[model samples]
Target: MTMEKLIRFAALAFFSIAPMAVATAQDSADYHVTVTLNWTEAAFPVGFPEDPHFSRFIGMTHNERFTLFADGQTASTGLGLVATNGRVSILKAELGEMTRRKRIGSVVEADALKAGAGVVQMTATLTSAHNRFSFATMVAPSPDWITGASGIVLNPDGPWLESLTLPLWVWDAGVDGGQTFTSPDDPLPVKESVRLAATPYFLHPAGLLPIGTVVFVRVR
Candidate 1:
């Protein structure tokens, strides 16, 4: 099989063979998630384009046994695809397999968003076991810049009573060395993914900063 096919097959096989976790009993609940991409001159360099835009938003509501990406852990090949190429098919397929296995409750993907202002909203199901949400989106033109939250617990101690909004920070997939928005290069796999250093690593002369916000609301 070709490398791409191999990747897809591997992803499918992974979730297929993985054991399902024992779910904890809890009252079922639904959540409305609103993810907004808000970028201003303060967030990115002046040279950032309005066209190419950020890649689609990809995420999953899953149990603690599953996570998409971690701060100091190695990034999966599906994550590498989203972070570097703005592609979602591979990851989506993988998540689909996970959903079938009951490892993930649901998967989410939004269209490519423009530079300044864009919003995508979706609803997700949550149980006591599958109470965490994780997501990611690629920063265009760069080698492997991405942004999203990992392991956001819906209701840690009690039920969510109010809507919550949090600032989203930029991350380096640690898989590429390019520094610019449009870094002309191929994916460079790293030993592992780490939190992007605090130093300015983007087009902004001053360095990197929070580029957006994510809002989660309890609808029922």
Candidate 2:
């Protein structure tokens, strides 16, 4: 081949391969998440239970197409299990399906907070394609109350936030009719949309107080 022709072919090959490389390259960031539960009787004196505690926490790093839980939406069977029974096996299976479908990047789980006031930490990896996070945990001994945050964007624009804190509010799974912490299992005849807990249990004299907080800090 002629020198000019060889040079032209080489340039075309490099440009084509460069575009493919750029398309396949994905930027990822690591974060350390700290979940602190403040559901002490001191902070929430109303209707304090005997053993105030939080259930096992489950979270996901996902893209815009996925949601762990959302307000005004019906709870999935797996989420219902968490809220009603503080179980994670079914939810983990659901997350596995989501992973197979490429809807989520990672599933993060943590040990339960045995006391009302404690902290649980976990690490997560977020890619540019999946920069949002969602998490949830049940209010132990409750009928169907849960606490969590959903649709949180770790990287809104191009840069990841150094640190972000989100207040955790109690939500009703709408799967049970029992209102108290130790109420017996009473499944609702029809499912209701998930929403913030409005029962007197969570209501304070001042207003609704958050039960916990989740803090995300970029580690790398």
Expressed as tens digits, the lDDT of each residue in 115-211 for candidate 1 is 6567877777777657888888887756787888888888877764357788788787877777666668755644456566353544355555667
TM-score of each: 0.77, 0.88
Q: What is the C-alpha lDDT of each candidate?
A: 0.74, 0.89
Pairs of residues clashing in candidate 2: none
Name the weakest run of 10 consecutive residues (lDDT summed) in model 1: 19-28
Best-performing candidate as measured by lDDT: 2
- Counted clashes in each candidate structure: 4, 0
Clashes of 2: 0
Write one digit per residue (lDDT tens) for candidate 2, span 1-220.
9999999999999998998786554377789999888888888777899998888999999888887778889999999999998999998999889899888889989989889999999899989878998888999889999998898998887788889998899999999999899999999989999999987877877888888899999998
